[model samples]
Target chain A: MKIGVIGGGQLGRMLALAGTPLGMDFAFLDPAPDACAAALGEHIRADYGDQDHLRQLADEVDLVTFEFESVPAETVAFLSRFVPVYPSAEALRIARDRWFEKSMFKDLGIPTPAFADIQSQADLDAAVAAIGLPAVLKTRTLGYDGKGQKVLRSAADAADAFAELGSVPCLLEGFVPFTGEVSLIAVRARDGETRFYPLVHNTHESGILRLSVASDAHPLQALAEDYAGRVLDQLQYVGVLAFEFFEVDGGLKANEIAPRVHNSGHWTIEGARCSQFENHLRAVAGLPLGATTRRGETAMLNFIGTVPPVEKVVALADCHLHHYGKAFKDGRKVGHATLLCADRATLDQRIADVQALIDA
Target chain B: MKIGVIGGGQLGRMLALAGTPLGMDFAFLDPAPDACAAALGEHIRADYGDQDHLRQLADEVDLVTFEFESVPAETVAFLSRFVPVYPSAEALRIARDRWFEKSMFKDLGIPTPAFADIQSQADLDAAVAAIGLPAVLKTRTLGYDGKGQKVLRSAADAADAFAELGSVPCLLEGFVPFTGEVSLIAVRARDGETRFYPLVHNTHESGILRLSVASDAHPLQALAEDYAGRVLDQLQYVGVLAFEFFEVDGGLKANEIAPRVHNSGHWTIEGARCSQFENHLRAVAGLPLGATTRRGETAMLNFIGTVPPVEKVVALADCHLHHYGKAFKDGRKVGHATLLCADRATLDQRIADVQALIDA
Candidate 1:
């Protein structure tokens, strides 16, 4: 089966890597000439919103899926007319905007921080008054990797926050004094069969994911699965979904949902019995979902900005390096390392060893 | 780094799949217009012995390697002038012909069935008289998958065997009344660091591999490693090598050596901490070899001739399908399935289930 991916980034590269062994081919549509995934498959170097390219991609592939949620909803809708797009246009529409995502979470009884749509300065002020200080003001759309968002700790910060964010449609969400952050990665097949990877403990630096360690028998696994199930069933989702949560008061609050395979689940490539990429392809291809069982004590460390030398990384025992074949740039995600160890002590040590390498 | 491969069959396809994640690129040189691995990287359609194409491949890649022993020695020698070729031309020379291979094994004190080179009809008669009945006559080169050979059960069988084998140089060998067949896959790095995966028990039908199950704590692992170590060190070999043996009287007799990745090691992709393909690329790329620790009870079943529907194979739990994307033909290896389980019972059951699917 040939899959049309809307974004030719590292996620798409990995999806191709996982799907290729299953006799699945890929064609990626990305505007960038040097899109990292172009080497793996056909690269349709056209904008996501280019209707001609979208039609061309839909014409060639059996089904279409997007690597990132930011793919314009109209693009999904346009392609959906020709081919089936997983995580549907409606899922993309709801996920691309924080307001709809949080509202859906709220409606489904999935806990979320106090949030209100803000369309004007007065709306921000009113939201701040109702939701209190120490809130976050975020653009309802086009926000990722901590961009297009601001933290409002006080009224002074909130004064220019609305204007600073280009005064666009926004959302004001009350801050959660969370003890930790976690994410649940789940896949639902077209037949409604769902499988969830264990919740992963995530550490964010500058609002970007830095590390994620797969949890084993976490106390909140059942609750996290229940919440993700509600969202999947509600959307009739058919692909991998990443649900981020802020752990507070021994519970999880929905942070956001990425309607595609996610970075937090990168460890699944080697750490799980079947990777999230393969599961996503399986679900999208109308095949049975694979086992999401964890293989070992696994942790994934993102290589932000630049990656360590390949030799140094491969020299480490039990370490798997995934370089995105992209040029190094400041604040860019060039690659990641996955560590699968027999015990937590070794995993922690390997993680620290890799962390030191990245820092150096 | 970019590497050039000589054959674009399933092995090359798998090598590309394994190396892509390491930020490595591939360009395959194969005459086949529809080589299965062509999708993974650049394909230079040319014969292996084509000087212009071989020079072109050598000029573009950091190093070169071949996936099969049948690659002509002159091709390896030609590529070696411009770029380093792993396993060396000499390794290929010795492995491509059965006489040289068995002679090397015998010289290393590695046990083998009695053998003699047959140059004429008298030579075959003399060898049959010396080696006794139930011997096999085989072409010295360009033979694979039970082709170019015939079994001699008696003098009448031996009378026409040499004439029937195209009057080419051949070898007559005493048949081993063995209980089982096994292969040891080992990798050697540039620094001479060597790692060996546990022995794999292989089953053959009509002289073609049908199944391979990785052995855990096999009684003869150390002995097999010792014998294979001799060959690796003797040749100063770099990259993955498979040494097949016939189990006899609770011991092993060297059968043949494939100076490249072997089919029996396919289970390492999921059953081992690091796979043979990755290790071979690492060794050739001057990187560190990965750990070869087996993950769980693992077995691989070859989908000979044709594969069952993808949905049927993937529907089984813990089954990883690797379809080669080749047109199915009788006696062809179209694909294979690797089953990983926590226990021997589960592995056995899954193996039977897959076997049933293939049969049905």
Candidate 2:
């Protein structure tokens, strides 16, 4: 089988790595000629909107999937006309627009932060009056890793929010005060059979995920799965769907959803029964779903911007290092390390050791 | 760091997969341009004895290692003059010849089947008389997976055995009436740090490895490790070395050794804390040795000659499939499957399911 990935990043690179062992080939369409995953398989360097390249990819592969939700939904729709695309272009269309995503959450009776679409300054002011202070203003589409979003702490902050956001189409969402943030990765086959990995607690610094630890038996696991199940059923989704939620008063409030494989789930490569990458490929390739049971205590640390000394990382016991073979740049995710420990105590100690090294 | 490999086979393919995540680059020297591993990294399509290509590879890599023992020791010796090579050319020199390997085993007080060298038909007759009836004759070098060897069941069978082996220099050895076979994979670092994976019980059909199960607390574990430790110390090995032994009356008898990664150790990919491939790369790259604790009960099944339907294999729970991407041919190793289970019963059940598929 040949899989065509729409974005060539770490996730695509990992997908190729996982799929190759299953006797699957890959072709990636990306705008950057030097995308980190280009070395792994066929990489067609062209803009996501390049109809010619998208057509070429669709013509070559048996099916199509994407690494990130930022790829234009229209491109997916264009490819879907010629070949099968997993998770459906409708999933992409909804995930890219925060308004569509949040509205769908409300329509399905799933709890989410209060929000309203903002088309202009007047709309922003009206939303603030109804939703109250400390709300967040975000562009409805093409935003990720904390980009294209602004926080309104008070009425004074609301006046300039629209101007600061380049006056683009956006949405104003109420602040979700919670104790923690957890995300669940759920995979659905075409047959509608669904499964989920355990909820993983995530930590972010300046909008980029820096740490994620698999939380076995977290009190909110069932609630998170319930919310995710509602979304997957609503979309009749096929492939891995990641949903992030805020823990408010011991209940989950849906935050956002990514219609692709997620960074927070990377620990599955070595820490779970079946890796998310392989499972995603399985779903899109029409293979039976794999078990999602957690193996043991595990934690994943993202190596943003720069990779640490190879010898030091390799020296850490039970630590597995992954470098993306990417050029170093500030705030870029160059690599990550996954640690497998026998118990929570050992997992904590190993995470601390890695944390100290990264902080230094 | 860049590592150069001496052969391009499944072992080398796996080594590259393990090394890529460690930020290491690779360049392989093999005679086949269509080597299965060619897609993984730089492929130098040239004969093993091509000094110019060998020199180019040595110049590009920070260190050198190999995937198979059939690679000539002199080729390794020649490359050593340009770059550092692991397992030492001396280790390969002794391992490639049956007479030298048996002598060294005897010198180290390791028990092996009684054997004698045959120079001619007269030598074969005299050796059979000395070693006893029901003996086996094999070439001194370049034989694997039941090739280039024959057996003498009795006086009537002795006449044709010499003629069957192309009249090459041979070794006549007594047959070991052992209960079973097992193999050990051990890694040693430049700093003298050593670690061992748990021994694996092996099943072979017509001398081709068919199945291997990680046997925890097997009665002969310590004896196998002790024997392997002697060889590592003697060679002062700096990478993974594999030792096969025949289980005789709950004890162990030494068989031949492989100076590189062995097929029987493929189970370690998902069965151990760190795989044998990663450990080999760590040793050659001068990194710390990883923990060898078994994850759980596991079994590996080798796919020979052809591959079964991929979807059927992927449907098996907790079963991981691997394909070498080589054109299938009779008697060729095409791939393998590793099944991880929580207990012996579950492991056996899963292995039986996969076994039925391969047998069909």
Measured by lDDT, the strongest candidate is: 1
Please give the range of 10 consecutive residues that has the lowest summed lDDT in model 1 chain A.
Answer: A69-78
In angstroms, give how far residue A252 of model 1 lies from its true place.
1.8
**Over the stretch B41-74, how does candidate 1's per-residue lDDT look in tens digits?**
9999999899999999999999999898898878
- Compose the digit string of candidate 2's lDDT tens values, residues B198-305: 999899999899999998988888888899999999988889999999998878898889898888899999998889999999998889888887889998999999
lDDT of 1 by residue, A3-43 (tens): 99999999999999999888888999999999989888999
Model 1: runs farther than 4 Å from truth? Answer: none
The local lDDT score (0 to 100) that residue A298 gets in candidate 2 is 93
Q: After superposing candidate 2, which stretches have Cα over 4 Å from the reference?
A: none
* CA lDDT, every model vs. true structure: 0.94, 0.90
User: For candidate 1, what's the TM-score of chain A, rounded to 2 decimals?
Assistant: 0.99
Candidate 1 residue B85 C-alpha distance from true site, Å: 0.9
